[model samples]
Target chain A: MIRAVLALARSDLFRWHRSPALVAATLIPALSMGVMVVALTYAVGRQPVALVIEDHGPVADHIIQIIRESDGFFLVERTREEALADMKAQRVAAVITIPAGFEDRVGSHDAKLDVFINNVDLDFSDDVRRSINEAVVEVDAPSLATLGENDLPPGTVSGIPNPYRIDVAERDLRTPDVSFLAYQMVPVLALLSLTAGALVTALAIAGEREVGALRLVRLSPVPRTAVVAGRLLGGTVASGALLSAVVLAATLTDVLSPPAGRWPLLMLLLLVTAVGSVGLGVLVGLLTRRVTTTAMLGVNVATASFLLGGGFTTIAFLPDFVQGVARAFPTYYAVEGVREVLFYDSMPTLGRNLAALTATAVVSLVVGSVALARVSARPH
Target chain B: MSSWWRAFDGGLRTQLRSFLRTPMTAFLVLILPINLLLLLSLFALTGYNAPTALVMGEDTAAARSYVEALEDTHNSFELRPMDLATAQDQLKRARLVAILEIPPGFEAGVQAGHTVPVNLTLDNVNLDMAEDVRRAVPAAAVIFAARNAFPEVRIEADLRNLLPRDTGYVQYLGVSAVALAACIAGAVLGGTVTAREWELGTARLSQLAPGGAAAVLAGRLAAAAVAGVVASSVTALIVWFGYSVHPVHPLEVGLTLVATVFACTMLGGLVGAGLRRVMPVAPLLIGTLLPFYLDSGALEPQRFDGEWLFALAHLSPTYYSVGVMEHAYHGLVVTPEPRWLLLLALVAIGLASLAALPRVARR
Candidate 1:
């Protein structure tokens, strides 16, 4: 039985080595994930803005200076007409216009700043609006007072009094801050593992069936269980190796931390995820029995898992209904488990995650084993 | 000329029949676009809701007023009144996004015109959500201060939106989704169909035909372009009816999709002729689609991202398609010269088609 399993595993390995397209398909998602992480870092924060200062007064200059100092705005000075044109072309997110007014308006404390924003994306537009509000606060900071400074005369002090202060003392409960790229890369790594294991197994099985090789195996005296076990073992090893390489690269590149004492937990989670994906892939192959259909199914399943299982976006950000659906996918547990170990330095939900993954792996393997046995028992 | 026309018609019919026979082709060309639209729309509808806990240490009027102020603001946080211990527990469990605590003597300090600090504990596990909380807290404080200050001094900042209306993230993505549908149908489905002939050893049939390979290839290209248009149109209709994004100029939307389909179809034909295999076509097209989708002002204007990405956007058909679609849907002029861009895209399509015709005609 062991010899039969080893022979089957070696054949599958040789097949994988010959099929460059299949190998490339398995690795494409991981490559794309890397690019996504880099792109996302560049995409967030620090939007471009056009500054059209119609007023040459000190107050206008001060506001412009404040806008420049804020990290949120990357300012480009333009004339009013030019700013309008640039905004129409989407070269800038918004146009900050200082209306024609003398510095005398500041003495009256009724100075107003006009802002024209292209509110296409609420998130980025909100950032622009918030920055503008902060600038307003800074401009008006001189007239404000601290908690107990109201009794002092306003003009007696050289500086401004900040009367109402709302201090935000942030206490983050997690470990050191994870970069956006690192945070998003965690799920991408898991997604790569899932896709590679499932698709490779499914394609290998379906391709064998298509080429009449599985029928030849069935006619032989080898036990059907050995063949199935060998296939699963081969897939798990291949996918596990790929996933480990990805994790190693991420850690070496400083995209993720290799938490000491947690490598065992991480490896266990990865192994279970691979086994579960391979089992699921064998089931898909048994059902489809065609390479093209199985490949399409694999792609669709991988995409659904990636999108709905918190691969690109956080599960907490999803709606309640979607979150419920996400919980049903094994990728969700794997992602959450990996993130908890790598980022938070704690294994709070390891038991639950492990139980879910193990349940998935056992159920899929049982069903797949039975189905493959039945198919092998059929007359060719 | 008559014989060539007859051959083209025959080839078109044959291509359509073959496409209908293949279940995968039908699914990719027809069903995938609708599925993507619905999924992307669902993603758009799932707005960000921050889970927050309000820890009131002192039941003072100012503290009560502050809590009320937070509740009244048009914020994304789902604030609930909880004790400190419960808040801490929830935060540790990742159930809560942030906790806002009003300490004791908060009302006295504020009533005496003192800068009383509001303790805000944030789970910065997700920095995007944390940033939202940071921005919202200060805005809420300003609102509370404005309401309670003795001398009412308000800053009058006149804000004007340049766009006709606010476009939601989903709505923006929906427009891009239409373009994306066009690309997938034209490239993946069309490329697969065209390449399958070579893979299945049927290219000789076209090479031996009376009308030559150009006529047969034209028919296939036409069928693929039509399928691309139909798929993209269905996606547009879904976006219109389902997402409430009505295009101001429906004709422009149609024209943009048709042009995109033609351009992408030719590009796919080039790929099909070059690769001569169906298995690699899907992955290649889909893999390339993502970077194009991301860089082509799908999420936001490409130019605003940075100069490099903005320059890179010019190389993708999606960028021009998105430009025209944005103009049609939201009346936003995202590109400086959209017509020129479209013309350039058409020129590229013509060049690619010319380049691919010889390859498809080869024995």
Candidate 2:
């Protein structure tokens, strides 16, 4: 049985290799996903702002120094006009204007400040607002400390305490090196499963029809179940090898640094996902008798699934309703399952996803088998 | 009087009928952009508070009071109490786009007449959102602090707010639909109807007819352009009427249709003629072309930032088609308006035809 599956898998893999277009389909998505991850990471990290100081006073200077110390922002002193121009150009992400007399006014209890931002760039504007507000809160920190002893609330800190306690816990399971690789690699899992699921079933059945092979296979005494299983095995092997290569590349390159205990479980998850993908492909092929229609449907579903499943962006940031809408697609599960393996180092949730995927596979296999059986049983 | 005109008319009618038949083509043509416009308008329903963050100095009840105050104050924000790393991750995903970190010595700094260090982590991906969070958070924090500390020094923000009115994902989608129409037309007809003829070796027989190779190629291009224009125009009209999207100009809108058809024809015809087989290569063509469709600002364009992507967008005839459509929707004065956009479109269409001519002529 192992040898048969292996033989089927090897043939399917070779078919992919021989077909230049199929090879391009898989390779382009993998590369595209890698590029997208880098773009997102860089976009997230590079946050710079323009700082406008209306008061060039000693106290305002002290606040500017504190702003410089934060390391969260880059402060460039520019006029209001300069800042607005820069913000419009997207050269400066946001603008912070420290109002005139900002420092002395804080002691007088009438401190007022104004900040300007180009609302077109929503993310950076939000960040600048937060940073500048914190700076204001910090400026008022000194004056508020000097009031009467009773003026302070119980928990309000008037001064430093005894021993400062610091506890650090790393919630991200993947290491930085693997984190980057995991970032690049995770997108492929979705690309592979959807492509594999749709392709295997469609091509296997369609190619047989084209070559007059399905007609002959139906004439044989071998149960239609055997033929369907054989094709499923072939698809599983192809998808498995492709997925395993991605895992091996990520692992070797330090992109997938799974905890030692989780290795067995991760492998199981990969195998199950591949099986489910193949079942989906077979079902698509069986339903769409025409080769062209099957192939088109396969590409459409694969591409659309990747975009809508939150594989490219975080699900949380998307509108509240879109997230729920995203879950209805299987691509979401593939991504969520893989993300769990990489981020949490746990597999039971992945196991549940695998179970769900397996159920989907079983149903697809049964439906595909019935459909193919009927088509084969026909006179033509 | 001319055979070319007859071929063109024949090509247009056959193409239009075939286009109207497919549910996929018709749906994408008529519904996708309109649906997107409706989706974008949903953003006008404001008062949905983005989840916010507050870093606590003492990690005690007072900190809870501070966070609860923020929550109760506005319908626009929900405060999340978190540590530095969690806050950082939230900001990274634009989840908690703003984070208020109360330093270890925050309360102590307040008491000693020292600078109390409070850090606000801002997600700068959306610059506007970052700025709003920056201003609103500090103002809220200072107001609370004023009631506690120096009650005399009332801190108020005279905000110079110049925020862009919220535009919908649908507007963006409306921009993308123009590009999608070209791709769908290319996918449905390009190189296929004609390439299918060539694959079946009917090209030789057609070449032997009275008008010959030029006439056949003209007919094929006419068919493709008609399909491309109708699909794109239908989508555009739906966007205009259904969503009230205003184009940069009526001429630019017409130009968008022309440019997309030319692009679809050149790319699809070139691929169709170049590949020898009909069935296998068709899937390959669709797969390879599929990315260009999605990537070409059809769904979203600004997310990618390589020089290659920029250069590709500039070079794409579809990009100009989409750009013209965008200018129309946004009503941007394209310098001298229609003249410059038309000149560029003509030059692009001319170049596209020239590139394909050599390849088709050899066949």
Candidate 3:
């Protein structure tokens, strides 16, 4: 059975050499997502803001220095006229202004900064709000903002704490903060694997079915189950080859850094995801039996499942019922499973997701084979 | 002239009837685009607020006020009261974004003159999320100090929004997805209809017709554009009723959606004629949509990303679509060009692509 499956798989894999468009079709979505990820890095970080410092006092200078030192805001000096014009034109996200206080207001401890922000959306607005709030707090409590940073500023003593009544200290669960782009890259890979594996396998099978080749396979000496198994293996290997390039590029460029010795586990999770996806392809291909329909449906199903399984956001962030629904799909497991191997050290949570993924692969292959056997023994 | 009109009318009617008769084209144009919007909007609905745990170690006036402050930053976190252990466990398993602890001495220290730290144990898996959490804590602190009249907290913010109100992320994305719908409709319907001639060997017939391929191409594009309009309207309605994203400028929204769809259909026609295959067009269009939307002003003004990326953004029809949609939906101008100019540009793009289709069709 294994040998038969291998032969079937090998034939399917080698057939791509005659048809390069098939390979290109499989990689398009994944490559486009890579481009989107690059675009997201621009969207989420370092927004451009114009700073108009009306007050030339020492405190204003200090705050200006803090704003410059702070993360996430792309600050530039702009005149009042230019800043307002830029804000009206949507050239900058926000305009920060310091009133001409003459440093006397600080003695009363009631200084205020006037900021004009273009509140387009919560994602952009919230970043500005949080950042402004952070900048304000750092004036009174710099230590709180610098939770991990050991560098001492010119004015403040290293050991000395601020005299504020309230302070906020945020401790990360993991060291070395992972980039949002990198974290999102995990689910996108799952999306790619699912899309590529399923789309390729389904298209191949459906193409064959169009010419009545699938029913012909049933007349072969090999067990029908082996043929389905071979399809699954072939799809996984083909997509695995393409996704492997992404994984390799990401690793080489330091776009993704999994935990030490976790590369094998990560690859295993990807293979499992592809297998499950390919299995699903077999089912879709068998059911549809049309190349175009399979291709269209494959893209839609993969996208929907990818989003439900937390492509852009955390599954925890999803509603209770939606989260429950997400858990039922292999994509949910694929994402969480990959994150387990990538982010966490212990990974006690990996077992359930792994089991679910493996079950998906097995069930799809079995169902596909059964359907293949049920088809009439005929030739085109 | 009359013959051209006849051929154009005939081409339009035939393709329009195909959408009704053919399952694949209907699925490609109407069902697929709507499904895309629904899935994305649904994801947006549940995915905004991070699920967090609020562990009140000492539930005093200060702690309770702190909770209120945390809650006031409405868009950031959805805090639920729980024990530290449960929160930690959930955080470890990726169920919670963070655990906010008012560690035993919080209220007392806050009531007193000494500084009291509110510990936020965060799952910093995604740095953007971690930044939001980190920033929210300080945001809450600003509220905390102001409410308590903490003297040492000197500087404060007097924020003035340039826009009247901030549009929610879901609404923004939903509106953007309307343009995405147009893009899909254009590519799939436009391409498939144009490519159908070649695939079914009718390109020869169109070539032999009195009006030549131009009239046939226009007829096909117009039919697809109407289908594209139908697809985007359904999406816009979904965005309206489903997500409460009411278009501020109804006339402009309608105009933009129609024009953008028309442009996209022409582009799709170009792609279809260029590829000359029905099989690859749908997947290619669907696959490329994400990057187009991402680089376009769908998330924000593409120019905000950077100059280089902004330059790339103009390459996408969705960028112009975004400018028009952002204005019509949210009442914000993302592009320097006038909306009328942008709309004209979109129409020009469609015409250019339509003109280019015949050249590809000859092959």
Candidate 4:
């Protein structure tokens, strides 16, 4: 049985090597995802934003000086027309225009300040708006007591003086920034492992039917269970190895933390997932009975799994019902397990997630095996 | 001309029947778009809840006074008597945008009429919410004082900046319909029918027919093109009837639909014939569709900035589809310029390549 499994796994690897199209199909998503992770991380980490000032007056200069004094913003432009053009082109994030006599009006306390920002950016637009508000917050307010003190005498302040002031307080309860790559890796690796497992199984089963090798396998002295088990074992090894390589590469590159404390348990959980996925592939292959259909079904399954697992967006933002539907999907557990290892830096929750993943894998494998056995037993 | 008409009719009938035959395929074609629209509608509904604010305080009367004042206002606040650790956790969960803290003044500043410093701690990561909180706090502070002063001093300033600007519902729905165009075209043009013919060794059947393979391929192309148009239009009408959003210009809509059908039909033919399998075709289609949907300016494009990202988005047929659809929904004139012509040319090239696939056939 071991020899049979080894032979099947070797043959599958050889097929993967020879088929450029299959290799390309599998690698395309991985490459794109890698690129996106890098691009977004870079964008978030260091965004170059210029504040273009249109006013040439001292007030404008003071405002620009204030902005320059602040840490996040860069005063990159001067002149309103140039700023507006740059803003439309997205070269500059915000433009602050101080209308003429702005300081004079503020001195008299009669004029209001107006600010404009291109709302295309939810992040940067809000940043500029806040900076402006903070500037206003820092400005000293002229009270009636101060006015009275200036108008009458310093000791002449009388009547029930206002005895109230607002006290603002804030608290932040947040997890540290988890690497977007690590966050994304959970779903990516799960999808990759499941897809590879399902594809290899489907291809092996469908290829036998297409090339008339199934009859040969059936006629051999080998028991049907041995043949099925060997094929599933081969698929399980291939998928488990594929995911292991990705996790290892990520660890070496510092994209993922090395598995710790319970590496063997993680491996066992991954193997279970692989076996279940193989069974699923075999069931789909048997039902479809066509290589093309098997491939299409495989792609559909992979894409739907990724979407349902909340790969591209946070699950918290999705509707409550969608979140419920997502929890029922197998990829959800796989993703959770991966995230536990990569982000939370914990082993216990990893065990729980892996246990759930193993349960799902076992259930799928049983249903798949039964379906495949029934289909194969039917007389041609 | 005669062959083209025959091709169109046969293609329409064959495509429709094929779509109806496979319920999953039909679901892929019809339901995915509706599902996305429904999802967007769901976002439009529950998304209107007032923005969330975070209020923090120590166990003091000043803290009590601040919380009461905030609660008296119209905004929603997640009030918590927390230490620094819990405050940090609340920020990560995004349950609180800004934290308001009152120091141990013991009511002395109010009695002395001194300007008391009220410190506001905000998650600088979310700049918008910080801005909103900054604006609301001062106003709420003023209003709270006014409630004790003359009741007539309760002049609420209509804060327009606190809310997002209106980018009409029709414009939003238009983007989804255009995105669905790519997926629908992919299913109709690239899926089982073309792949099955290739796999069954029956592509040779068409290749050996009259006018050689090109004529048969042209017929399929013509059919696929017509099928793409009808499918896109039906989905467009759903947006119109279900959402009561009309295209800005009927002519622009017609031209845009025609261009999109051509582009998708050609993409389907080329990808289907080149891959010669439904599985590869589906992934390729989905892989291409994903990024296009994300960057279509439907929700947020300003989040990420890269010339290459924008360049890739420019190549997507959905981008042009969205542009023309937006223009149509706004009652603007849709002109078929050089860019449109170029897209049409690409579609033609795709059809020719698919027609020539017999030469590229493996074994």
Tell me model 3's lDDT, rounded to 2 decimals: 0.78
Cα error, residue B223 of model 1, in Å, equals 3.1
CAPRI rating of model 3: medium
Ranking by lDDT: 3, 1, 2, 4
List each candidate's DockQ score.
0.42, 0.21, 0.58, 0.20
Q: For model 4, what fraction of the real interface contacts is kept?
A: 0.14
TM-score, chain A only, candidate 4, equals 0.74
- TM-score for each model: 0.89, 0.71, 0.94, 0.73
- What lDDT does each candidate get? 0.73, 0.55, 0.78, 0.54
What digit string (tens of lDDT, one per residue) describes model 2 on residues A1-380?
A: 55554554566667777876555544554455555455444443224567787886766777677666543465677888898776664456557777777877867767676766543333333444555555555554432222111243422444432111110111221222233335435646777765664575576677667666778866666666666666777777667777777778867877677666767766766666667677778777766655545555665566556655544454555567876775666766666676666554334456666777667667777777677777777666
Give each prediction's root-mean-square deviation over alpha carbons. Answer: 4.8, 7.9, 3.0, 8.4
Candidate 4 chain A least-lDDT 10 residues: A141-150
Rank candidates, DockQ, best first. 3, 1, 2, 4
Chain B TM-score of all predictions, in order? 0.86, 0.59, 0.94, 0.61
Better of 3 and 4 by DockQ: 3
Candidate 2 is scored at a TM of: 0.71
| Deviation from truth (RMSD, Å), model 4 | 8.4
Q: For every candidate, what share of the true interface contacts is present?
A: 0.41, 0.19, 0.70, 0.14
What's the TM-score of chain A alone for every prediction? 0.88, 0.73, 0.90, 0.74
For model 2 chain B, where is the 10-residue window of minimal lDDT? B38-47
lDDT of 2 by residue, B1-363 (tens): 476566545555655566566545344433433332333233212213556676676764434444554564333366677777888665654355566666566455545544443444444333233334434544455545544554433445454545444234455555556555555565445656556556557666666646565566566666666665766677677777766777658777776667666666666666666654444444455444444443444432332223355455554455555546656575432112253664476457645754775476476
lDDT of 1 at A316: 62
Report the Cα lDDT for candidate 4. Answer: 0.54
Model 4 C-alpha lDDT per residue in residues A241-285, reported as the tens digit of each score:
778888788778876663466466556655666666777778777
